[model samples]
Target: MKYKKLIFSSIGISLFCLVILLFFVLRGNFFKYTDINSMISEPKTNSLIVSGTWELSSITSLSDGSEVKSSEEKLYITENFVYFEKMGTTNPKFKFRQVNFKNYLLYNGVVTDKINIDTDDVIVVSIRDERNFYKEFIVLDKNKIATIYNKKYYIFEKKSDNVDKSIIEELSLDESSINPKKDISFLIGVKSIGTKDVDYETFLIRKNGDEKPTADKVEGLFVNNKNKFFLVNANENEVFVTNDYINNTNKISLGVKNATINFLSKNYISLESYNAETNKKNYSIYKIGELSDESQMSIKDIAGDKGEKAYFNDIRKLGYSSDNINLYDMKNFGVKRNNFSWVFKGILSNYSHDNFVSSEIDLDLIPNVDIFSNKSSKISKLRVKEKVPDVLDYFVSPDESVIVILTADDISMYEIKNQEIATLPIFTTSLKNRREVVTFQWTNAISSELTYTEFMKIKRSN
Candidate 1:
C-alpha cells in the first residue's frame, strides 16, 4: 500500500510540470514570431487634439502656449476664427455664440464675433437655441462665415456688408456652410438645413455646374477640390460617394434596408449590410458612372464565422486613396496573462491593384505592417510605432503612399518610404462631453474584403 501511494504522488508531480512547460512554450512561441519591441519603439507624431472622457468642452493652444477655451459640445476652427454651441441651463434649445480666447486672457467678459478673419488666431464660443438643433460652419473669410444651423445652411457675412437700400438680394440663411470656389459653391445636408422638412430622400449639394452627388441621406460631407462625396445613410445602411447620388435609388436591391457606404473611388464603394442574418457583413465594389445593378459586385462570406457579429464592432472610416484604402480591424488570436482578451490585430489596407498589406499588433501595442506583393510574391513587414494608444482615425493621400493617423492625443503622419513614422501631438484642450460621445473604441479582427476600411477606422476601439 505504501508503494501504491508513492506512485500516485509521482504521477501528480509530472502532470503539474507538464502544464507549466506548456504555458511557457506557447508564450515564447508567440513572441518569437511577432516582434513586439521594435514595433512599439517606432517614432510618433502629435497634433493639437483634445482628449477626455465625455468631452463637452475644449481649449486650443497657439504654438506660443497660450490656450483658448470654448464649449466642447460643438467645436469649430478656421484659419482665423472658432465657434461653439451652447444651451442655457434651463433652455430647451441650443444657440450659437462666438468666442475670443484673447479676450478671456485679458478679462472675463462675453466675446462675440460678427465677422470672420484670416489668421492663426483661435477662438472659442457657445450659443443658445430654442429647439434641439445642431450647427456646423465653414469659415469663408474674415468678416464672413458659412454655417448650417437649425436645418439651414447660411452665409453670414458681416452685418456691415448689408447695403440695405439698393435692390437687396440676400443670400439664403436656411442652409449651412457652403464651399465657395469662384463660380462653384457646394452645399451639404440640404434637407436638414432647408426650411421645409422633406426627410431628404435623395440629395447632393455641389457646384451648380458639376455632377450632383448620389446618396439617399447624406449625413456627412467631405470634399477635395472638384471631388466631393457624402456619407449617405440610406434606410440605415450607408453609401459613401460624391456624385452618382441619384443612380443608387433605382439600382440596388435595398428593400427599405439601411446600409453604410464608404467611398473608395470612382469605381469602387465599400458597403456593409447591417440587416443581414447574424449581422453578416459584406463589401461591394461598383463601377463608376454606371447604375447600381450594372456596376455593383459583392463578395458574400468574409472573415469566416467568427466575424459574423464581431465585424460590426470594428468598423470605422479611416481614409480613401485613388487605388488603395487604409483601415484597421481587430483580431482575437488568444488571451493575455491579465485575463483581458488579447486584442491582437492591425490594419488590412488595399493598394496597387489588388496588392495588400496585412498588419499585426505586437504585445507592446504597435502595428507591424506586412507587405504582400502578390504580383511579385514577396512579403515584407515594416514596424511602425504609434504615439496614440490605438490608431483611431486616418486620412490617406491620393497615392496611398502616406497616411495621417488621428489618435486621442495626437495625429501622426506616416510615409511608406523606408518605414518611417512621424508623431505630431496637437495642442488642444480636453473636454468631457465630446470625448465620450464621438470617439474611437475597440473590437475584434477578421480576414475579409467584405469589411470596409471606413467601418474599421470609425468603430470605437475597446
Candidate 2:
C-alpha cells in the first residue's frame, strides 16, 4: 500500500512538469514576434499606415498632448488587402472584398500601392538621402500609428515628441517634425501618382512657357494680388515669393495648405483648414507671418465665407468666393482649372477645378462661364467653348483686360474684340503664370462661383 501511494505521487509530479515546459516554450515564441516595443528606442519606426490589419492603439493629438484609447477594434493588413476585424462580433472579418491597387474603394475595400504582398513583411516609412531613400509617408513620429475605423483613418501619435526642434525651426516647419539623414526635404503632399518613375508634379503642375516642370516633385504655386510664393524645391522645403509682380524674390515661410499670390498677405489673412484624415477644421488667422488671437474665435465668428453645401450635386461640395468680389487690386487674375470631364452632361469638372468655382451644375450645362456685372444686375456669359480646346487651365486679369489660356499642348494670349479679356498682361511679356488662384479683379464677377452666403453680406454692406 505504501509503494502504491509513492507511484501515484510520481505520476502526478511528471505530468505537472510537462505542462509547465510547454507553456514557457509557446509563450516565448509568441511574444517575441507579436509584442511591439512600448517605447521605440529609435525615432523612426516601421510604418503604421492604416491598411491591412492593425489593432487599435491610443490616439495622441499634436494640438494638445491628449490621448484616447480604443483597443477593441482590429483592422489588419496582409499582402493583398487591408481589412477590419472586431473581437465580440458575429462578423469577424469586416472586409467585404479584395481589390486591385489601381482601384480606390468607395466602400468595404482597402486600397494601397505602398505595400508588396509578397515582399514587404512589415509596413515601414523611411527618410534617407537620395531617391531610393524616399517612401510614401505622412507621419509625426515613429511611435505614431494610424488605425482604421468608421471608414476613416485615425493617426495615433506618441505623447512624447522626441524629434530635434532645431530642424523644424530652420525649415520653418510645424511641431510634428522628423529628422532626415542629411539636408531635409519636406515632400509633404500625398503621393498623387502611384508609379515611382513618374515625376512628383504629375498632378500639381507648374506653369512655364517651356515644357513640364523638371523637378521630381513640386508644391503647386499660389499667388494673390500682393505676393506670389512657391516652394524652391519640394525636397528642400525652401519657400520664395515675388512681391507686386515686379519679380522680387524674398523668402517667406507659410503654414497654409494651398496658396495664391499674397498667400501670406504680408499683413493679415484668414484661412480655414480641414484635415482630410481626421476631418477636423482649424480656423487660423495669420498676421505678419504669425498666428493671431483672432484665430481662437469660434468657427461661427470667423470672418469670410464658410464653405456651404453646393447648391449643385449630391457630391459633397463647398462655395468658395473671392475675398472681395468687387475689388480689383491686381491687374490679371488666374484660376487653376484642371480635370475637365466628359460625362452624360457633355463636359463637367470631375473635381474642384476653379478657385472661384461653386457651380458644378452650370459647368455641366454648357461651356459658357457666367459673370454677374457688379456695375449692373446683368449677367454676362463668356463663350469659353472657343478657348477650351484641350485646355488644362487659364488666367484672367483682374480688370478683365487679359485672358491667358493654357491648353494641354499650347499657351495662347492674343487680343480679340472688346469681349473684356483683350489686352497685353501688365506684368508678363508672355502669358506665363505659375500661381493657382490669382485675384480675379474683373468688373463683372463670376456670380455662379462666388460664395452665395458671403456674397450677399458684402453686397448688402456695399
Candidate 3:
C-alpha cells in the first residue's frame, strides 16, 4: 500500500507541471492575436491586416443587380485617411478618419460613422439614411478582402509588394550586352535643341542601334518603335514620316495655313485650323501615308454646342481602352490682364466611332488622366501635398501599369497598381530661355520587363 501511494503522488506532481506549462503557451498565443502593432505593420512584412492598397477586382451592384468586373477602381487605407477612386472620376475621393485595433471613425466627410470590428476579422460599417439604414461587412484576410454592401459583395485583392530585380537592368540600358530593342527593352532619351527655331530633339536608345539616332525637328512627336516615328512641324506646314532611319524622312503637305498639328497614332493625325471664309474653327483627321481626309467633324457635332468657341489643344490615345481617344479643348471666356485671367474653360471628351462622352474641367484644378476598363472607367488625378512642378511631357505604359511624368529637372514614374511614385535617374538638359520638350514612347517589348525596383525605391526614398 505504501509503494502504491508513493507512485500515485509522483504522477500527480507531473500532471501539475504540465498544466502550468500549457497555460503559459496558450497565454503567449493570445497576446500575439491581440497585438495591434503586429497586425498593422507594413504590408511587405505582414499580411493579416487591411493597411495597404486594395484594388477593386469585382463588384456586384445593388442598383442594377449586375456583377461588374473593375480593375481601375482602387481603395487606399492608411492610419489617417481612406482614399477611394471610382470609375469615371477625375480625382480620388478622400475621407479623413482614425483607425484603432478594433474600431474606426470617420471624422469628416459626407458620411460620418464609427465602424466596429469582429473576432472573425470582419469590419462592420453602418450608415443611416432617411429612407433606409445600410450596413457593410468587409471580410479581411492576409491578401484579400470581400466587402459586402447592400446585399452585394465587392472583392479586392492586395497588391503585391515584391520588387522585380529586372528593373535595374532595364533602366540601365547603356550597360546591357543584348540588343535593347530586340530583347523588348528600350529607353526614351530627349535632348533639347538650343536654337530658337527648333522645339524638340528626340531620339531612341537601343542596344542594337547606333549610340543615338539623329534628333528630328518636330512640333509634335510619336514613336511606334525604333524603326518608325511620326512628326508634325507646323512651321513647315508638313507631317514628316521617318522609317528604317531618321535620315530617311518623307514629308506630306497638309495645305492648311496656321494649322496646329497633333500626331494621334501611326495611322492618324489630327489637324486643327481656322477657316477665314466661314469665320469658324475646323477639325479634321487625315491618314498618315496618303494624307487623305478620314473624318471631317466639327467640335459641335461631337460635343454639344456651348455658347463659346472651343479650340483643340491636345489629343491622346486612352490606354487599355479599345481604340478610345481623349480630346482636350480649351477656351478663354473671361478677360485677361497681363498674366491674370478671370476665367478659362477646358473640356475633355472620350471619343470613339460609336460613342461620345464629354465633361467640363476646372482650370484651377490639376488635370487628371483617365483610365478605362471594360466595365467602368476611372480618372486618376495627381494628389500631392506639395506643389507639383510644371509637366513638360508624360507617357503611359501600354499595360496601363505605370505613368512617367517629365519636368524640366526630373522625371517621375507613378505605379498605378500600387499607388506609388518613383523618380528616375534621367534629367532634362533644357535651358531657361529655350523651350523644354520631353516626350515618351512606350513599347510592349520593353515595358513588360520593368520590375518592382522602381516601386521599392519610392518607399525607401520616402
Identify the candidate with maximal TM-score.
Answer: 3
Question: Model 3 compared with the native: what TM-score?
Answer: 0.35
Clashes of 3: 4
Whole-model lDDT per candidate: 0.29, 0.29, 0.38
Candidate No. with top lDDT: 3
Error of 2 at 75 (Å): 64
Off by over 4 Å in 3: 1-222, 225-232, 242-249, 275-281, 293-403, 408-418, 423-428, 431-439, 444-462
- Which pairs in model 3 have colliding backbones? 88-377, 164-452, 184-445, 184-446
Candidate 2: regions farther than 4 A off? 1-288, 291-382, 420-462
Q: How would you encode candidate 1's per-residue C-alpha lDDT over 60-146 as one tens digit per residue?
A: 222222222322233333222223331111221222333332333223221224222344333222322333223333334445444
Worst 10 residues of 2 by lDDT: 179-188
Clashes of each: 84, 23, 4
Instruction: Please identify model 1 stretches exceeding 4 Å from their true place.
Output: 1-231, 235-256, 274-281, 291-294, 298-386, 393-403, 408-423, 426-462
